[model samples]
Target: MKTLTYVSTKSVNDLTWPTTYDNTNIYSSALSVLTDFQTAGPRVIESNTRADELVQLMKKEHVRMKIVVDTHNHFVGVISLEDLSEDVFIKQVAEGYKRSELMVADLMRPKETLLALSYTSLKNSDIESLLYSQRENTLQHLLVIDEGTKTIRGLISSNDIVRQLRLDVDVAFSSFEHTYHSAILGQKFQSRSLKVA
Candidate 1:
């Protein structure tokens, strides 16, 4: 009996330090994407907005998360759809309370929350794990803040990740494959009339 010639190559995989993306670079500007809220971030509630209004904003943004702010725009608390599931809001609406009458303060989680800064370096694995640990399986949105003021400076979403990866993949497999090592993605942070970081 004769055996066909065969060849196999052995390979080893090694762990690498996660690549970081500065949230300051990836986050959407406070003045741009935050069309829903005129102030800065999705924080301020008109102090007159109803629960229905909040729900509508959440649905429209497709974020399902919100940060409540006082009239001074001071960060107050956070509101999440989970807080007002059918169990609570339904009962209140049935009792004839308008969404406007329900202040965001009344329905928001405590001020202590998982806040982050715009300049912070975001590691993909760490962020992903953080969200999972909070029981948030897939993070559609994450807020980037100003470390000095704890104020929101911008926002980030999963789509951004996909966009970046696609860009990188394209460059890696292109004609410049031999020079791909020099194609690093570096981010410079800036905002209107100021250095964001």
Candidate 2:
């Protein structure tokens, strides 16, 4: 194994807001999640990757979704927990074999919903607001990418953003906004119910 250390400068480009929607001001550089600890950075899949390969890898790692990168290293699409859940849904529909029997191609949904670009502020809400909104929504994950390359640079699920902000469930509950928190709120709501309620 090889380890490489490089110096990086912190900039606004590196900054990200938490799900709080409170605009509490979180510097993306403040905390480095596992996403930053990666050596090759993050696990990536080619467009041609088989559904079976992705399913096995995701299940093994307990991952709900992944970013799709092409041979040119260009961002193509996103895969979500809902997309992966297709395997289980499929099995339920067929009542035939286990979900493990399905492949990524057969199950993974095409990348559709998105949260591209880190610098782009979400809902123009504060940190707390963002969190509440994300939780109430139907999306399970949100991807942050480079606007120019459109390549995924980071992903922030309602869970990921919440954990980063260290917000409490009670606090989140007291501040849930019914409007202007669509994407964030919608996604979280989806995960908890596994349905876009």
Best by lDDT: 2
Q: Could you tell me which 10 consecutive residues in candidate 2 have the lowest summed lDDT?
A: 171-180
Off by over 4 Å in 2: 1-40, 86-126, 132-136, 148-151, 165-197
The local distance difference test score of model 1 is 0.48
**The best candidate in terms of TM-score:** 2
Residue 66 local lDDT, model 2: 76
Model 1 TM-score is 0.43
How many clashes in each candidate? 3, 34
lDDT string for model 2 (1-197, tens) is 99999876764365676544344233333123224312336555666676556766877887666766678866567665566555566655587755545544445445564444352454243544444434445555555555555455555455545455554433222222322243354546768887545
Query: TM-score per candidate, in order?
Result: 0.43, 0.49
